[model samples]
Target chain A: MSFKDILNSGKFVVTAEVGPPKGTDIKEMIHHIELLKGKVDALNVTDNQSAVMRICSMAVCRICLDHGVEPILQMTCRDRNRIGLQSDLLGASVLNIKNVLCMTGDHVLAGDHKQAKPVYDLESVQLLGVVNSLNNGKDMSGNDLRGATDFFQGAVVTPEANPLEPQLIKFEKKVKAGAKFFQSQAIYDINRFKEFMKYARRFPVKMLAGIVVLKSAGMANFINNNVPGIRVPQELIDELKAAGKEKALDTGLNIAARHIKQLKDENICDGVHIMAIGMEDKVPIIMERAGLL
Target chain B: MIITKKRELQELMENLKNYKSFFLIGCSECASLCGTGNQEAIDSLTESLKAEGKEVTGGFVPKTGCQVLGTKVELKPFKEALDKSDCILVMSCGAGTQAAVEIFEDKPVYPTNDSLFLGNMTRFQMFDERCSLCGKCILDKTGGICPVTACPKGILNGPCGGCKDGKCEVSPDIKCAWVRIYERMKRLDKLQELCDTVLEAKDWSQNIKPRTLATRPEKKEEKKK
Candidate 1:
């Protein structure tokens, strides 16, 4: 399905992630693509998540498109300058990668290498502005492009942050900057997410509340304490902890399913992003449990 | 040209309890180079701050942060924003951060990143710190490739035995500096010099570390006076 159709369908849309392989081997990628095709509305290909070197996200998206999966190509402003970013957007248009998620990306220091430099020519919001400018047939410097692009531009939002005001304000700015849709950082607390949805509903943009699968209680707590802007509530943590070692994966799936069910039941968001991290295989099962299948 | 990630705007908002109105400044030059304070980052910061319940009185002013020319133009448009602000959160390198401090002397100026050094972006979102500016350059001997700058270990005389099949031991994909020097010399047909000259160990003191270059000609003139 086209991303626009999925957005307008008014159904609880489901999207999954497909991280490009680190090397030239596309076998794992192909498997995940096949697994997610027809099962989810769209797939998001991460561009070097955590700054570790990987096969380009564009190439992986192309593979998914060939296999009949609509791909949301996640493009980051971390590595490329404005010129390169503009060129890549044009290239994505040619390749027919319909959706683009612009991000500022993790710092080079966050990756394995300690001494790497960064090229922050454009952050995510300006990139959205630049994309909007490109759509109007002008580059960021006001120079005209050979042809204009019509991309379903999207940006990220973190709803579970302690100070929820920034996410809402950025959400509004992103909408102003020409962002049509938003995929939030993982949502673990239903009440907090509902509060975020209350503020988010005022904006015109579509929101796909993120659902990250917790491998264990420890993992969820780590993301809550260590990862800024992500706060998993104590109840969810206790639920995962009670599941024990053998049933951890089952507990994670159940938690994800419950979150999706609540979001769909409450009409909290336009869509949902199921991020299983390395557990891509379990996503289909979670979707089935959520009755999204 | 140190590269850094600002604590996410949401996190920055929580930390900023006292500040009400603030100036959100970004660099148009080197901070852009290091991938920190550019227009894109500034916009994100602006959106993020506005969402956090603080009034963002300032907008983005892309400046060189190093030279006065860009700073001068930026100061005019940003003056009102600066005056309205309780603090200035600079999204630039140390030079740009200090420039903001000097320009807005009375206002509180905060650095978004710990300014590291001039570096080049490498493959896979990685940034390699290549340039050290050791005061003296010896590109003449190495066929335009400096072993000291390029090599991870900083070995000057020859390739260490750790080099395996032309790749540095430190990073497999990264080429050995000596291998690159050899190829460059070979391309220039200076390969025969490898046998004739036994180069001495580099004098450690000659390349004495912390080197600074003054770009402000007026400052140099004042020093001369």
Candidate 2:
């Protein structure tokens, strides 16, 4: 089904993120894509997420499409300029990959290779502008193109950030720049998300609050301290800590299920983007526990 | 114009360090265009020297080394190497060599290679300087062929007056620029103008003198203020 139809259906549309492998071994990625194929509305293929280089997002998306799974091609403005971006977009359109998620990626310094050069000719906002421009059959330089693209453009948002006004402002800007949907950063607090949704309802774009599967208390604490705009409250951290060593994965999945159930029950968001990181296998279990399967 | 391999750069670094206090100079113009001695190249060279147990002090400066502007600037930041070493391993074209010689006056300046003619950038890994920057630009009149630049003999009058089945006297692959120009002009229906003007000898002074550097005072003030 088309991404637009899935969103407009008004059901609790389930989505997930599947990171491609570091090398060309597509076994793990393919397994996850197939596992989540008909179970989720769409799957997002991250583009060098967290500043770590991996297999090309487009290649993974192509594999997902071949496997009968809908793919959301995540693109970051960190590594390519507008020219390369437009070229990749045109290539995606030709390849029949429809969904896209635009992001201002993590800084190069945060990656394994610190010396890599950053090509930020167009930030996320400007990238959205370029995508809109290409839809009108024109490139960033005002050069006319042979044909146009009709992509289901998506953008990212962080609702749990302190002083969430900036995110809200950027959300409005992204919607104005032709972002049809948004998938937020990991959400640990449902009330905070509800507040975000109150502001979000004024706009027309659909949103899917992020639900990252916490592997352990340590993992939750690491994200809380290291990852900006994502805060796992002390109560959840303590609960994960109390789960003991052997049941860490179970506790993590339970927390994820709880988050999803709260989001669905409260009607906080239109969908949930389950980011299990390396634990893609447990996504189905989390969905099942949340009564989404 | 001149291309230096990574191994050649390592060898040059060794030689520069062995001699006198050395300043590994880079060019921003031709070197950048050639993609051999830009900032990225300099950084790689610096890392190579560090790996080889040498404490060479050097930094990169943008602009053609042969230009007076890049030379007059303070290279003293690399003074530790310059004061202790005897030579400068300049990664620039021949123009860079002249500029380094003019700046260091007494210091020995060695060239990596002879600077060649101007060429179009084919790819990231290759560059071919095909143009000689002849005074006249007859691209519009001759469908983008400079007979003076491409022809080895700088023949502007005719195809060497010895047409051996439309091939040049220099080489078979090297199609005579005039022949190509004439054919292109004929295709474009502008062949009549090709016979109208008799070209004269080029004035060497157009490129013979040293280039002067000029900066707008307002731009400098705006940057400073």
Candidate 3:
């Protein structure tokens, strides 16, 4: 079934992220696709995730289609201007890769190429508007297109952001921009997320709580220190530390699984978008542990 | 005001290697306040060039280096020095460097400073950019806060998923532009307005490079004819 259909079916939608390799070697990526094909509703191919250079997400999305898996093409405004972004959207549509997650991408300074120019010609809200425009058979300039796209557009939100008012304002803007679905930034505090949902439930859109599996207490600490808009609670860190070195990975998976199960059981939101970064192989384990399989 | 940072002497030397004698030009406006094109800066460069065994023909700080006609008139006294020089080093913004280029057709001109941004000097030797000159102004709608310059990503509808503790993801020292806008709007009792409005895609054609504008009434009258 199409991702749109799955989202409309009221079933708990599961989406996982897959980062393309830095080099042309696709064996590892294909292996990931093979492992994750039927497990999740669709695989979101990241666009140079974390601003690190990688193979294009469009190509990986096309590859997923060939392997009988739905693909959500993640596009960032950090690298492409409106022209490039619109052109890529048309290209993705032609490739039959419809699901798109618009984001204002990480800064170029955050990436490997610190000196590279950051092209944020369109931010997430504007990009979502652009996607809606394309789907309606026009470009950003209101010019006609030879053929329009039929894209299931998605955007991102940060429920855990400090000074939550700004994020809430932008979130409402994203919804108005024609974002059909939203995959949020990583979430750890369920109660805080529930509080955000109290406001978000008013919108006529689907929300997916983002889940990033923790590998260790050190990794959790690093995320708390470095990652923006995300704070892993001290309790989770203590739990990971207590799990011991060898079993921490399993502990991390359990934490992710527990979050998913709660989100699903409580109908907190529509679904979950798991970002098992660099640990795509462990996603299936998380799903199975969550009773999703 | 235009913010400028002086280029490294070693790098400037590479550009000036082929030239023997040099004439320097400085701006008494923004560059002076920036300490990049003041009289003291010119004297320091003169000493450095003399130490490097290169001849300093002469130099002057113009009232406004970007005013082509006035700068040309002001530079008349330096004709002999300019004639003797192989290069002209402009110690101001890019506009000042281009002024030197326009004034001296034969001599190779180089900038001694990098024009960083249009900004205000918030403190002694401290500057903050408050405008991006994006051609269109949305300050009235944004409670007078310009996100195009304040936000590193120039996101119109932000803070984008990277804001933490009201600080920007790019730097903890920098406050999120949207948060500031939110606060300003709230203070003005325009929070509901802020929430109700959704900014459309920016008309970047207005920001197209090499942009030119003439605000003179004479030009408008001539165009009307």
For this target, which candidate reaches the highest lDDT against the unseen true structure? 3
TM-scores, in order shown?
A: 0.59, 0.62, 0.95
List model 1 lDDT by residue over A1-293, tens digit each. Answer: 58778797786789999998788888887998999889999999999887787889999889999999999999987688778999999999899888999876765656765477666556666678878888899987778888898888998887765434323444555677789998988888888788878878888888998988988899987876567566788888888889898998799899899889889988989989988888899999999898788
lDDT of 3: 0.92
> DockQ: which is higher, 1 or 3?
3
In the order shown, the chain A TM-scores of the predictions are 0.97, 0.96, 0.98
Query: Residue B68's C-alpha lDDT in candidate 3?
Result: 92
The digit string of per-residue lDDT tens for model 2 on A39-80 reads 998899999976788888998888889999889999987788
Q: Can you write out model 1's per-residue Cα lDDT over B1-225, one digit (the tens) per residue?
A: 455555655466565778898887787766776567777777777777778777778757565775655685767866776788898888877777787778777878777766666677775335776766655576777777776668654544445323445555456677877678777777888865533333333444555545555675567667788
**What RMSD, rounded to one decimal, does every model reach?**
25.1, 21.0, 2.3
lDDT of 3 by residue, A65-126 (tens): 99989999999999988999999999999999989999999998888998999999899988
Of the two candidates 1 and 3, the one with more favorable TM-score, higher being better, is 3
Which residue pairs overlap in candidate 3's backbone?
none
Residue-wise C-alpha lDDT for candidate 3, range B1-225, written one tens digit per residue? 999999989999999888899999999999999999999999999999998889999999999999999999999998999899889999999999998899888879999999999998999879999998999998987999998889999888768888878888889899999999999999999999998877776787898899988775667667788
> Candidate 1 clash total?
7
Report the candidate with higher lDDT, 2 versus 3: 3
- Regions more than 4 Å wrong, model 2: B1-225
Worst 10 residues of 3 chain A by lDDT: A159-168
